[model samples]
Target: MTDAPGSEGPEPSEPPTSRREGGGLRRAHSAADASASTTTGARSARAEFETHVAHARAEFEEANERIKQRTGRDLILAIVIGVAIGVVVVASLIFFKWIFLLFAIAATSLGVFEFVRALRASGRRVDLIPQLLGGVVLMLSGYFVDLWLHWVLTMVVVVVLIVWRLLGQMFSRDGRTYGAVLSDVLITGLVVLYVPFLGSLAMILLSQDGGEWWALAFIIITVAADTGAYVTGLTIGRHPMAPRISPKKTWEGFGGAFVAALIAGVLLALYMLGLPWWTGLIIGAVILGTATIGDLGESMVKRDLGIKDMSSWLPGHGGVLDRLDSILPSATAALALFYLLSPLAVS
Candidate 1:
């Protein structure tokens, strides 16, 4: 009021330091709040990213599963078709042994062709004519021609073909593929003889005194075993047994097959075809067990050849091998069973 100009201002408020310190406290609190917000935002962003990644992974898995399902359905379809044809053909040849024999020979020839194709797929160049002749010889060997003459023809054909092939290889200007030749021959032999050998026994069974019904029962048992395995595996399959070769097969499936086969055998004895369920039971157990070996054997061949199916002739079904793998071994067992039980032959 007295001296300095106008004594203006109003009280000067408080000291600048006191005001600044209050402002400083406010700034520090605000900065801390901002930092907390930043951290929370970062955590939320991370959680969102993780959720998106999980969604993507689940979608990928679902797509893969769908592909496998479609593949399995196609395969099952083919097998059913092929099996149906076979059942019809076999049923037709029920009485005429010669007609059945001819069918068996032709079927074996087709089988040999498929096997050679598999070998060739594995990079083996095989001579077709010699192998084809050998298969023909094997298929016809079961015919009841003049015993001595048939034997002579079989021995001569085998010797001449083998020698001729070997000489061709030894004198080849570009060298021969012994691996291919041997593999082709061996595969052809197995293919031609495998089913015919087993089927021929059924012929033998039917020809015996009043053994027609028993022969029919013999065929029925194999169908029963295969049906059991397929149905059971599709239902309660859990643990994968062989994913690389056969993804759908499970140990549980095998157990079911065994049980089904055993029951069918019993039924055969009791009612169906009048096989005497007790005898059917024994036959069932033997055939189912050995049939597993045949199934695995074909699997082994496919695995070695790096092939999925033996061929693509039948739609939905892979090849003749695919349909026959499990049943082929059963043929041998059935034949042996017949010899053991039938009146005509003794094993």
Candidate 2:
């Protein structure tokens, strides 16, 4: 080939670009370098992305582990408290006929206080006087509810609440009205009376019946139901029953509770309480239904207050009220059923 431009004969082998114009070869070299740099940058970005993902995964795992640890601790605490209180109550029943009734009244009072506090926390005003009056009336009438006082006290509650609301509006502050006061009073009365007041019936049944096997049976079945639901919910719950109110409650857990409650009933009745299978089954059904109702009721309360968990008073259980809320209704219903059907009713 002829010498390229000024180059001598047998021109040096230039790259394809410079072969035509040396400038072309220079541009080609630069393009290759730029492309290699871009590729290297892409690799570096990918590497950084992987590192970030690993860090996020580690944090997530750590959080889950901490949650699990807290859960285990709470469960242990619940068992201890339940066992201790149950032991004390059982021991007292031997020496006192109505000690648990006093306990029930005290619990009702405390529960009422807790409820009102929740209301106030949620930007609602609840005059303590009327609520306390209603609560006291409800408590006193607890004994006579099976007879004549229950309906009367309920009527009184309704009336007092209505009057309280009228008085409250008349005494409005800075154009603010206590319009919800009436509803609050009425609902609180019903909850305190029906839940804790009537719950005293369980105590009456056990202490007065000359046999506490039934009470023990109730404790066992309900405890089993609670345990089963909790355990199964933690592991296998997929479909939520009430996602907004109780995210943890699920159909799968409920089914597990039903089965566990039935098993608990069978064990308690046949082996411990020495009752017939039919009776055991009946008790199990009652426990299952009441357990669900109690849970739903408490869930409703917490939801109304725009809060999660009644309080963190009881490490694992949320609050004293939360833990006792379900049991109150369940205990009351069990006793009422006993008074109507059990051998204790023969008297």
Candidate 3:
């Protein structure tokens, strides 16, 4: 037993080796020396462990400081650029219908470009020109025609791309690998769907009578959800929503998104889009679900390609795809709702 602090106790003493005349004295000295050695070693090891822990803590803090310094300017720049884009898009939708379509084409083209660049970075061979041409055609077709003709034009573009790929294979000996050619064809189709095909939905929405308001409502609800998630996640996020996919996203953030989206949906539906409050609530929920999936989908792509951002096109935004990740899937949902509950149907 050991003595308790503040209690009267004998001070521990080492048996003198010089008094090792008897067998009992020698044993006492040996036991004392052994105990003293063990205590010293344990203290030394504990000191070493604490030193290592302190060093690690300092390094972590330094890295965090560096990241904070770097992102400070980029964050401000990204916000400024984002606000400018929102104003331009809203203005175009209000005054110039043709300008809106042109903007969509440009954005769709850039989206295709970013996708091809990411594929190339991953050593995937993609025919850029054919995919680019196909994206433009897909957008123009959707903008000009009804839903039925839009599907026909989509098939026509796909067939043309198939022939275009075959012609390229015939011309280039090095591009004749069966696996590479197959990958190129599939990737071309994906680029179309991922960027232009889904993107054309925006044009479809805008072409309808009083469709600009519908388009604006969609944009506002989606943006609100994103903002809510980001702010909530940063403030109180603890449990990760998808740790393997997006470690930063949390269930708490999703809850925040749901609340914000619901409010935005109800208000926009009642005032802007001429729908009931209940309809807006449903739309908000749908958009939130689709937008979350879209963000995860892009994260999956980045994980597969072994790259951080698609490209450094936008400073803090990463790339066009990064910004459009939530928008594309939400756009598809919005388009479906428009068809089912056409705002123009009542009139």
84-195: candidate 2 lDDT, tens digit per residue: 8777666655566456556666666667677778877886666666766676666556553453556666667757765675677567764663456555556555654655
RMSD of 1: 16.7
Best by TM-score: 3
| Residue 88 lDDT, candidate 2, scale 0-100 | 66
Candidate number that wins on lDDT, 1 or 3: 3
The TM-score that candidate 3 achieves is 0.76
Candidate 2 collision pairs: 18-25, 311-318
| Residue-wise C-alpha lDDT for candidate 1, range 1-347, written one tens digit per residue | 37689766676445447877989878988999999999999999999999999999888668645534734545445457857876765675566666666665666666667877777777764445665666566446535544365446555655665566566656765655667668545544454345445444444454555455565565667677777876677677676667666767788778788898888888876674444546767878998887778777788778888887888776666776676676666666776776676542222
Question: Candidate 1 — number of clashing residue pairs?
Answer: 4
The ten-residue window of minimal lDDT in model 3 covers: 67-76
Lowest summed lDDT across 10 adjacent residues in model 2 is found at: 338-347
Best by lDDT: 3
- By lDDT: ranked, best first: 3, 2, 1
lDDT for model 2, please: 0.69
The C-alpha stretches of model 1 lying farther than 4 A from their native spots are 1-71, 75-83, 145-161, 176-215, 242-245, 272-275, 343-347
